[model samples]
Target: MSSLTVAYAVAFYVAAAVLVLGLVVKIKQYATTPSPLKIPTMPAPRTRLGVVLRILREVIYFESLFKSNKWIWICAVLFHAGLWLVLARHLRYFIEPVWFWVVLVQPFGIYAGFAMIAGLVALWARRIVVNRVRYISGPSDHLMLALLVGIGFSGMMLRFVERTDIIAVKAFFLGLLRFDLQPLPAEMPLLVHLGLVITLMIVFPFSKLLHVPGVFFSPSRAQVDDAREKRHLAPWAAKLDAERDSAAAE
Candidate 1:
């Protein structure tokens, strides 16, 4: 086996193992922690109308993303669009015989790679130009984006420049899924491209890039719509104080 083959295997396993172990450790930490900080629940709006408006503003307008730098939002949109197309196009790997739809899908896959590369570049540019972003931009952020962009660019090169054999590559993937080590496409370029992609997938769950998933779990977003038609919590805080005093007197 060539050194490239070994590199492919090593990168894939290292990534997979780290991703799994990281998730287990993270979950354990979250589970064992007592809630040390009570989030001061914001005052619920006074009127049902106000609550509805707030919900509409948050859910529809994505007020949180907008509140952040505009470039962040742009990067997010392109990243999502690019990722979706890549994953969707990859389904062709498992399916036998080219469907008529794949013809339409081909250009989209190329476009997706371009989008990912552009988004990553723009995001990196923001980190360089914006003082706040620059301060926060750590090694993991740079590494993550670099890996993603590498995967996108390499894949593009394999498709356009090198013209890798898709069928043999698909067979190799299917074999791997079946726990068989079949001979992969001999195309070094495509293998290198896929290797980086597998690495990104492995590291993704552990990285701050996980905010992609974390947004759904965020308390502010989760709690916003649920606060409808309740009394303002600022008033409730006072009421609770009064109750505590009454209890002391008793």
Candidate 2:
């Protein structure tokens, strides 16, 4: 096995561990964080089921963003939709027998890559050009955008410009799952693409990208708008109230 193969295999293992464990930890924190007040945004759902559907709509369609800004919403949808398709297409590399849906998606994945890049470019440009967005833009935001663009660009190059042995590439990832090390092509474009991917996975849990999961736990969206009809008390506050009632009864 080439040194590149061994190094990348190790890197994959570490990145996967960090990605999984970090997400678990952060999501736990989000879940456990208490909301002591009913602070749902206006026009919020009154029932639990309605809240769930509202969250679903928000997640799938970026409903609030659409209402707020059309341009940003368009870019977000293009990037996110393309990303989902590309991810589904990538399952061929990981699965032994690719799913029928994945095989069907392979053709569109290439075009989706272009959309993904375009959306990212537009979003990044907004941060640079728009006075309000540019004023609040931080280094980390720009860095994240640059990294994603680099990953997408390098991936396109590997697919179109510097063609490598894709069979070997798939085998390498499959081997990682089976605990067998397969030879990874050391083509410079391939290596660069893989390196950026690994970096993204490792940093994902700590980055603003974590909004992917954090959205589900957002108090404003998750909370029901029934405060007038029902009292809302956090766990700790309820426990303290119970103790007070018992003391007064004694």
Candidate 3:
């Protein structure tokens, strides 16, 4: 019940609220935006089921990224795969009885942290070294990468260089979930990692990180290539057509 604990607890709760609410609002907007054109990328799926499968492949395998650039794809895949494993392993901290699968992945998660850092570094380097990418890169892009790299490096330091009281960390998080604030460990590395994580959560909804959810709503990816087979009309356009017909009849 120290002031530090209270501050962190409040920060985390506020960050979580912002993250969830922001994503909800953004997703609603994406869903409601009408696409009046059947403009899927070339070689796109013709059927709805096929589009679903295509999107799955894009999400799971980064198919388009792979086709576009091999090195970038490799780095992205490594980072994302490592991130998933690390996140799954973190379930041990939040849940009471750790799931068997989470327990099984615990060891791999440690190594995954290394891979995540490596991939992030490579990606950042690409933004700096590649002229085309660097030209388009802005301050926010670099800052985002720095933030993620800081998070991964601090987390790795906590695990390898200076081990903290993980039990206390788990208790803190679990307490937060139950509306009970517990004292967070005062370890510098752990504090840095947690702070960065909270910052990421708060900024995620407004940042390019939104591409995670935005991908699903992309008209180019979500729409089926049926322009040839049927007329495509937005909801507003359809309403206009209906009004026009009514006026003509009158």
Task: Give me the candidate number with maximum lDDT.
Answer: 2
- Give the C-alpha miss distance for residue 56 in model 2, angstroms: 1.0
Clashing pairs in 3: none
Query: Candidate 1's error at 107, in angstroms?
Result: 2.2
After the best TM-score superposition of candidate 1, give how far the Cα of residue 240 lies from its true spot, in angstroms.
14
In model 1, pairs of residues that clash are none
- Candidate 3, lDDT over the whole model: 0.92
| Cα deviation of 31, candidate 2, in Å | 0.9
Candidate 2 deviant stretches above 4 angstroms: 239-250
TM-score to native of every candidate shown: 0.70, 0.95, 0.95
Error of 3 at 164 (Å): 0.6
**TM-score of decoy 1:** 0.70
Q: Model 3, 117: alpha-carbon shift in Å?
A: 0.5
lDDT string, candidate 3, 84-130, tens digits:
98898889999988999999999999999989989999999999999
Q: In terms of lDDT, which candidate is stronger, 2 or 3?
A: 2
| Model 1 poorest 10 in a row by lDDT | 32-41
